[model samples]
Target: MMLSARLLLAATALCCFATTFAISMDGFATGHKCRCLTTTSEVIPTRLFRRIEILAPGPHCGNIEILVTLKSNNVVCVSPDEKWIIELIARISRNRQQKKPEVFSADQHVLK
Candidate 1:
């Protein structure tokens, strides 16, 4: 009876471990998206600060997309697809300064 109990416990533990491994491999599991934080600031002039949301999956992290709607100019524009939202912000900064256009990586979903 003692031997059988030990074996049952061992099997249960193994099954739990396997289930956890499988879930982690799936990527973007439940409650995983809440780990990130976003901050918004006005770029001045016609553009107003807006919120950032993750539209699609990414490689290590995830693809961060920013939605900006200009209240004064009455226009809405979404940042182009990029690996990180920071790159898009950099481009906007350049444009604000009347500098050359910048390019950033568009690859979002990258499996581990």
Candidate 2:
């Protein structure tokens, strides 16, 4: 009777371990899928955007993802192929470049 009880406990423990491992593996496999389920081509004004994220294509997803967070606290995915989206990206890039601080040069320093 004691031997049978021991075997039953071992079987239960093994089943629990296998179930937990399978659940974790399933989550890991699905976590890499693309975040965007749909994209909009409608133009959203830059002024309304509070944040913008550009995600490059990876093994998990084959398309570039543009995610915008608006001032209203809403997140939207914009289509990368849209003309307005392209222009928005260019404008943002230019702005970022212009905002970079110029390196200090010794030649420009006034002799004290």
Best of the candidates, TM-score: 2
lDDT of 1: 0.54
Q: After superposition, how far is residue 20 of candidate 2 from its true place, in Å?
A: 32
Off by more than 4 A, model 1? 1-9, 24-61, 72-79, 82-88, 91-112
Candidate-wise lDDT, in order: 0.54, 0.88
lDDT of 2 at 56: 96
TM-score, cand. 1: 0.29
Poorest 10 consecutive residues by lDDT, candidate 2: 22-31
Query: CA shift at 58, candidate 1, in angstroms?
Result: 9.4
Per-residue C-alpha lDDT of model 2 across residues 17-103, encoded as one tens digit per residue: 988887534336656777788999998988999999999998667789999999999999999999999987898799999999979
Q: lDDT of model 2 at residue 28?
A: 61
lDDT of 1 by residue, 76-96 (tens): 334444334457667667888
* Number of the predicted model whose lDDT against the real structure is largest: 2
- Judged by lDDT against the true structure, how good is candidate 2? 0.88
Q: State residue 106's C-alpha deviation in candidate 2, in Å.
A: 8.2
RMSD of each: 14.4, 7.3
